[model samples]
Target: MPKIVRHGTRVGGDALSIRIVAPPERRASRGSVFVPPLIGGSGMQQVGYFRELNRRGYRLVTFDYRGHGKSGGRFFVRNTIEDARAVLEELRGEFAGEPLFGVADCFGCIPLLCAAAERPEAFRALALFNPIPSLQHVAGPREVLANYFLPRDGSGARRLALRNPFDLRGMLYATNQRLFPGVDKSRDHFGILRYTRARTWLATWEYLSSRPLAGVVSAVPALVCFGRSDRLLGLEDPAAEERYRALWLRHLPRCEVRVLADVDHYWTGTQARASVAAADFFERGGAVANALPGSTLAPRARYRDPGEAPGRKNQLGGWSRSSGLKRASGR
Candidate 1:
């Protein structure tokens, strides 16, 4: 595989660092782009995603945002969007073929959506997983039932952050130690990512109340994946669901929403399924305005439930693990 190139540039009064993993051998066709999570700096290089993607004809690009990894400025609202613009500008300058769309997880969605809003033409598609959505909505609920179910007490936001001081760190010291043991953090990551509890709380709040998402993006193809189990508990109330519906209806009416069973927020046990959905959306040439279902735009021609196949192991006949092209079955 070709080695990833490291470089730094100044953007919006901040110094940013990024690692661009070029294909070892150039391909005749353009490959998909992979944008990683900002919370965990275990970027493409460290995750071995670059290597796998390299062989698969993808040119994986990973970068450290100003605050999270090895970049210069302090992390704050709007900066994520600015950083994304910087990366896209750089990639646009270097890559020749079609602009690549990407996949982002958790808080990563804030910047991705922000960037998409700014330059929908620059991307081919987007697949977001368990996004932070509206930080304000996630942090605090507006309804009595929502407040009752998704309490912001000790067990909610504060509890998760307090569980580990470095829980929100981009460097991922804990994930490295816990998952890979003797993993390399410095060579693979950059920046002081140990976000303080206060910073975490404030950042989440800001992400929710940040700039508008509707006018920013056009009718670009998008896929949203959220684990069935990771339901934003705040939406327990029907009214809350309406609020969410309004949010998406406003910004991404063309996007397809997929809820994977047994998949946690991280899709830990079902990464394969999430991966398939993402790749399949792109391979199927993506859609606009409820073409693939799950949209509020169309309901009658919606996709069928998996079990409706009567009884079969490969009910969906989705892309097989062997040939990652896509699940062979269709809606």
Candidate 2:
């Protein structure tokens, strides 16, 4: 087992907890930093996947945002972009001359993109999973208003009951679901409400709704992956993948898009597949620069089980196919 090192970095008076996994042998020529999702998401949860990448001869680094996991200070949506920038700067210094890659999940993609935009030369490539291109596409007015009205600080239960009584019942139901063992264990529904200050949640909603992705260009090779069955992000819509693909292409001109079969918002049972795909992309140098963006809804060869016949429906109800990466037709 490779020794896992824990460290801390100061970012504007906040102490961010970071973990680094080094390869078992000599230092690696490549390194990747992972940016975790907001709310209940923590870098600690990704240690297993990072260890796998480390075993593949790549240095892996992941950290928790302030006020989340082992980090110190209150969580603020606006501070996330700087947090990402600081971490990336550290990685660039440590991995000098080595190709650096980035991987972000869900809302985490927002800050990563922003930081990458500010320093496009810092990364050779990027991979985003279940990215939220825009909050308007996923949230409704009622959800926005509820978060906006929440009190800044207090007992979460009492605050919801007092400030937004209408939402209290739904909050109770979600809390029950979170507390019930083995019930929707793959998802996080109440973490923001239960753990964060309500003001932070509202700020996050506002920041995302403002279309922060607009006009932000990173110009780095990027691979964007989405789950075909992502109910949380409503990716089940046949056109949703294309919509996100188009948005990412606008920011990352050299981009690739793939839809994973049976994957969910949290990746769930298909995490290994996702990890392998990401590792392969990084290994390939994130696709040659200047190549037109490739798009495919078909599963990669590694995604298929050995001896699985082509055209047969897998357990996920998606057909298995053998194919190499190819340019998606019709734009």
Candidate 3:
């Protein structure tokens, strides 16, 4: 069942709209939140993912950010945290039983990390995938807007033709801070961009700091997965993998981390396989499940029986240790 709700109190000041998928027969009472990508408010890319998660008997909630989708707002940088909080409040209000799980993608996870550090009551478990906190991609606001709204058309020319990085970015920084969200291409998320630029600098600034996520410590279980290939790292200096590992290890000791293979910064070929792994990981009560084939949809990673472990198939075609992910990872 998909239901819509007014996420705000005002009549016309601006209301957030949320779409939820209720569990089938078990009558799920717990809810999981999936934060959409920068410009993907309609969540069309996630429908298939939601369908699969619904089968797991979990109530899943997704919403258009302040400006990106059905919600009211204009585009802008820095409003990420506020929107995440608003969504969390709605879920907490609707569900009285079951755990609150959060799954954040790409730039969407920053605010949640900020919230976990500042407002811990918001949610419980979290699954963050390839969340890059630094806005080091550019220095100006116009560039920020373009990067947020531009489609990854897979065209070098299209990407470069979209905007002039140096000049536009300078213009953005020179513009007034109170009303810049309007510059972002997405009309729906513009309002939030406008409001957040005016008040959400604290989290952004802290995230840019040397310690960055130092303040965050999730009491609830957390899963942080990074694609093996991300353009974020420039060679040696600070390998992206090591940086993330160090950050989470220090701030979130209970966190579990995984490096997805055969993928790059964009997660090109491994999306389905990765999502399946993630869904299984979450549904399995936070246990670390090994990946299957290039993918596996098994609820709990039972792998093969001891006898059928990877190497020896014995007489029967049943169990084998050489066949499972744990054996490969030596887990």
Q: Candidate 1 has what TM-score?
A: 0.63
Please give the CA lDDT of all the candidate structures: 0.52, 0.59, 0.46
List, residue by residue over 121-211, the lDDT tens digit for candidate 2: 8888888877776655555555545444543344554244344445533443333332222221222233322233325346545645567
Worst 10 residues of 3 by lDDT: 322-331
- Tens digits of lDDT, candidate 1, 1-331: 3656776668977787777766666564346474744443424322232133344455666666556546777766566667777887777777756658776766667677777777777778887766665444333423322333333555445222224333343323333232222222332332234453126566645644665353654466888765444443233344754565456546665777754445544343345555566666766666643443343231122222212311112211121121111222221
Candidate scoring better on lDDT of 1 and 3: 1
Give model 1 RMSD, 1 decimal.
Answer: 10.4
C-alpha RMSD of each candidate structure in angstroms: 10.4, 11.0, 13.9
Estimate, for each residue in 2-71, the C-alpha lDDT of model 3 and write its tens digit: 4333343211255665666566665554356554434322432333333445556656666555554456
Model 2 vs. true fold: TM: 0.71
Clash number for model 3?
25
Each prediction's TM-score against the native?
0.63, 0.71, 0.59
Q: Cα deviation of 66 in candidate 2 (Å)?
A: 1.0
